[model samples]
Target chain A: AQSVTQLDSQVPVFEEAPVELRCNYSSSVSVYLFWYVQYPNQGLQLLLKYLSGSTLVKGINGFEAEFNKSQTSFHLRKPSVHISDTAEYFCAVSDYGSGNTGKLIFGQGTTLQVKP
Target chain B: DTAVSQTPKYLVTQMGNDKSIKCEQNLGHDTMYWYKQDSKKFLKIMFSYNNKELIINETVPNRFSPKSPDKAHLNLHINSLELGDSAVYFCASSQRTGNEKLFFGSGTQLSVL
Candidate 1:
């Protein structure tokens, strides 16, 4: 079975400050990782994804994540955030063993509150 | 035009009533899925269909049924709803199976009272 765990339930940071949201996963087989963002009263949007290649992946809105295979972790980071960055972030994983069903196991979302 | 869309953005119904949420994707994706988001913001996949064929059915109750009339349309029907059934239901689609990026609908918020 595959599972994802978000270390924080909520994170509060002042605007223009740096932020990191930690995510850890456990899977017996190879996996693909992704980050999604959801704004208030809106659907989720893909932030970035890690399928293969370099461990460091950059995403939209100046967001990036590093995939540490040994650590089994993919943490999202932003050097500076704006008030509009306040939203819910989710970490998800899909394992290759599922036979390409496109089924994703998501972690409990982390609410990012960008204080002004 | 919206890439993915679900009807009845907000649905409020009494317990024991039956309801259905309709979903369609204009992107012409071959796979569609239904996901549930609980109050705690935990998302779980309920059902998935590939080209109108059922591909994945999670450990969800039988009362929840999904139908895909075509490759671009997937609808979810719930019977005898309970208080626990009150959650936001999302419909998503991808270009194909296999770890592809998904486009999600705005979601249908179902409230059982």
Candidate 2:
């Protein structure tokens, strides 16, 4: 079975500061990785995905993640964050060859607290 | 218009009671899924349907059932609910199966007392 692990449960950073949210996954076969953001009282929105592309993937809101196959990591990074960037972030993975079910296994979320 | 929508943004019911959550998608997607988000913010897939056909059913209890009346609608019904079921339920859809980007609804927060 595939599983995802988010190293940090919470990340606190000041506005205009750089931040990184760590994520690692364990899978027997190839997988598709994704990062999603969820604001308060809202559904998750896809930040970005790595699906047979370049190692570095850029997403909305100036967020980017690098897929490190050797390390089994896909850490999200932002050069600078804003106050509105405070939200719950999730890391998810789905098997590349799971008969097209698209079932996602998510890790425990990381809360991004942006302070002024 | 909302690409994906779920009814009853919040539901409060007593244990042993039954409840239903409805979902619909206007994105014309063929695949729909139900995901449960626990109190710890862990998300797990519970069920999925494609073109009104059940394709994936996780290790969910029999008390929880899903019905898809059409390709655009999927409804989840739970009988004899328990406190453990108190969590946010999300409905999502994809243009197709296999690594497609999923669109999620706002979610239904169910609280079982």
Question: Per-residue alpha-carbon lDDT of model 2 for A68-91, expressed as tens digits?
Answer: 999999999999999999999999
Candidate 2 regions off by >4 Å? Answer: none
DockQ of candidate 2? 0.84
Q: Residue A6 error for model 1, in Å?
A: 0.2
Residue A101 shift from truth in candidate 1, angstroms: 1.3
lDDT of 1 by residue, A13-112 (tens): 9999999999999999999999999898778899999999999999999999999999999999999999999999999999877376889999999999
**Candidates' C-alpha lDDT:** 0.95, 0.95
Fnat for the candidates in order: 0.73, 0.82
How do the residues B10-68 of candidate 1 rate in per-residue lDDT, one tens digit apiece? Answer: 99999999999999999989999999999998999999998899999999999999999
Q: What is the TM-score of chain A in candidate 2?
A: 0.98
- Second chain TM-score per prediction? 0.99, 0.99
